[model samples]
Target chain A: MTADLLQQTIWLAAVLFAIGFIGLMVRRNMLFMLLSLELMLNAAALLFICGGAVWGQADGQVMFIIVLTVAGAEVAVGLGLLIQLQRRCKSLDIDRLSKMGETE
Target chain B: MSSDSLLSLLPLICISVTIMILMLQIVLVPGDRLSYWLTVIGVVATLWATFFITPLLPQQATILLTVDAEARLFSQILVICTLLLLPFCHRIPTARGSSAEYLLLLLLTLLGALVLASASHMAALVIGVELISLSLVVMIAYPFAPQYSTALETGIKYLLLSGVASAVLLFGAGLTYIGLGALEFSAISQAFTDIDLMEQGLVLSGLMMVIAAIGFKLSLAPFHLWTADLYQGAPLLSATVLATLAKAAMALALFRFYLAADLAVLQVINLGIALLAILSMLTGNLLALFQRDLRRIMAGSSIAHFGYLMVLLVAISTLHSVEGAAQSRALLAWVIYLVTYLAATLAVFSVMLHIAPASEAFHQTQLKGLCQRHPLSGWVLLLAMLSLAGIPLTAGFIGKFYIFTEAVNGTLWGLLLTLIAASAIGLFYYLKVVLMLISPAEGAEADPVTGRWLTRLPIILIALFIVFVGIYPPSLIDLLSQL
Candidate 1:
């Protein structure tokens, strides 16, 4: 990739990351929050691939693969926990999950 | 890699092979007792191997890992902690029945921690962190009792937050790679020192993001919102793992990274870490003062403890180079501080788990007349509280004293003042718990269930070590200073 193209890619990844972070903050539902997390992770992966292509090295691409694997594992465990949360709290809203302080 | 290089990785390999074997045993035989004993033996063997492999002396196992003395020391500490924690895991009341999987997850977490302690490449760093947090997510929610519904909430919260932190860390690492065109720590350091050839903005922001992500994992101030909830919500044993192994691994990794980094961006990074340290100290202690539950108090206190440790990062920045006498002193102080913190934290949690393995919240009132009823646990908790408070003639005091002197030597007057003030504030709640433990109950309180000697042995040894180290600090100082 050309220098100009790599700069543009960086900007695109930055913007994508901002969107994901905002989505994470704004969303109240557990599933959407997890999706937002995936978005953020993908943006990071994009940055790695862009860097790899521009720098002419395999390490960035290797990191990209690793990031993808990490994101996949996170989602698998996340969805499992979310299902359990859904069953126990009877809701997927993060606001409804404030049962920490009350006496059992 | 040569055979010697593979041999240097004996500690990690031992743990990994043990985890695989435990997984197979769980699948086929499916017995908790057998699995538990198997894990204990595996961890003990790993601990022995870690010590045994030290003669090899700083071998690079691959491009990914550096099995140095620091790595070996932390690996030993983590493995020993796992061994100490296994009995409590077995003792923890799991209403969900058949908790053999918890042991498996714990070992995986240990493997992650060991990887982190030795990580010399970006890939190793990310993998280690993900392994630790993901397994922790499952372990946090392992006790599926309806009464502890917050366990699920804590798990979800930790999962989402930790996920964000990992992404942030990766994004930062990606940007860093773009600026420097390398993922190895040595290359990054070399490129960073040649500042004119680097993209300063890319490297700076990328490093800041990486530090912020680590701060979240460490639960420093402004990133510490989830700590109290996690402490209160998770099972006590898992919380102990979170407090000791997880924090120690991340902190040690950060410390090693700081050691490898040159002076190009040292000023900015040091300032950021110093700010984090101050905020964590003030906020952790101040927040703990109002907490009624023991776990929540520990949450606040742990944040503060890490804050105190962060000051050493600033001390490193003050040194002219990485190989100075001052730097060695700082490293010595750090290891001693971490060891004492681990011993004291494990002691406190051991007492908590022994006291109430089934309760959701360990309230202050629950500890009424603990000394009169259960002298051994009461004394251990009291000593732990005093050690945490940094009172003289306790292990915590020794750790604090070294940190105090390092801050003075570094001329960090502002941070030193904050450390002093925070410890004072910390002393209140710590003593409050101590007083409550020692004082007689207002009404009738049942006697504590003093479990078998096996359960009490860890606490007794920890308490004895606390006093032993406190009175004779030179032995530890001499040993660690050589590192």
Candidate 2:
């Protein structure tokens, strides 16, 4: 029964990672990309909790807590940046970020 | 009862208190010069605390943190760099409404860096890394100038990349925990010895994942695409802090981790690092050659510098035959390199901030006639550029010489050759800046305004340190050897 639960958790993580990667690669919206990043972080935390359960150890759980903290910090900073970007460009499309290139 | 154990946490405590006080003051009192001065005092106090208390900590404090002489020394340098940045922050016309928030974030970033410097555990290390990253996001976007759209975009890039890196770090941590059932460095080292090859592979992958994330932070090749843009877009103060303090802290942490880990089983990863080093050197120097913007040029130079540092790191990983003197010498060389590199970079950035027009335009042409108008600032910048180019009679030359010497003794001849070639390419761009500063301007005279004395003082001090260290490096080397 534990094995089944573990498999299900792993599957969920895999799905989340896939979705996040697709969103990161395919989506042009910067906000969506950030959301996808959050999704990726959540998947990592889910994996950590599942791993902790399987190993019967608290290290993974402790790590999950840290991951949660990092995610929260990231969102706070990320959204602040998003607001600034929106104010400047009135849009958050990733494609418009050509200012990153050398010549630009 | 150990002095080291108690002293280890002093900087952290001082910084935390200072951050709280600064935040509270910002909330209560109106944002003004007083708040800025408070923040500067906070950073200075932290610097003193780092010097006085850090030396007392036990050489290696706990499984998660080390209070060794090396970490303390780097922490001291980082504190000084943060202090040097204060005046620049004050003088620069901040696009953001409140300079207080900028100062607050800068202090928090410093606190995070100090934590990372002493981190001996994976959890502590990750936390430190994230703390610095989160604060940097604010620093990068703090200048809300219309031209700062690029800065905002770069912040978003850093945000997303850092988030992914953290997740990768967690994933790696989870795998390592599953394999070794522990997060402590010493236990992980022990586990590597007892575990089977497959289990070892799992642990290795974990380390590599963390390294990848760190490489992004360090601006090493394949992960350095974000550096030039971010540095270019951010304010001069933000760029200097990111390039110097943040990179120094991360590099020191990585060095300690490599020392503690079972490096023997990680031969492939070390080799991969060497390859990346070469690529970064070639790419960074080559790309920097044509850059018109000063910030982009510095960004490219930083990438190349990291390449050289990585060479030293790769050598340290492989040189198991030499235990005491050789190892200590290599480590000392790296420490000295970091100190000298930070000083040179900060001095250069300080001069750039002074010369930059109030209009916030940073084009190369703006630097014209600088030598005629402000001879002192021009000379300081000239010295800084020469030092960065590793010209004779400068700190950078000595640092590179020591690193290459170590690389040669370690038999990393190929990397050493590439390093020399890259340094030559780097010289062109550094000289280009010097040329711009010295060359006569066509129409307008350079701004006659001497920058703030507080700002000018640090630039002179850093320049003096560069020359002193360049001429006589033995004392600094001796101090680093004790680490």
TM-score top scorer: 1
| Cand. 1 Cα-lDDT | 0.86
Q: Compose the digit string of candidate 1's lDDT tens values, residues A1-104.
A: 98789889999999999999999999999999999999999999999999889888888888888988999999999999888778867889877777433534
TM-scores of chain A across candidates: 0.91, 0.85
Find the 10 residues in a row with the least total lDDT in model 2 chain B: B353-362
| lDDT of candidate 2 over B312-417, digit per residue (tens) | 8877765656676787778877888888788888887888776662333377776676778788787888888898899888888888988888898788889988
Which residue runs does candidate 2 get wrong by more than 4 Å? A1-15, A96-104, B1-7, B59-63, B95-97, B143-149, B262-265, B357-361
Whole-model lDDT, candidate 2?
0.78
lDDT of 2 by residue, A1-104 (tens): 26578667767876887798778768888788888888888887887787777778887888888888888878877787778667766778756665443345
Kindly report which residue stretches of model 1 are placed more than 4 angstroms away from their true locations once superposed.
Answer: A99-104, B144-147, B195-198, B263-265, B321-323, B445-450
Candidate 2's DockQ: 0.55
Clashing pairs in 2: B4-B56, B4-B57, B4-B58, B5-B58, B64-B120, B64-B121, B65-B120
Candidate 2 global TM-score: 0.93
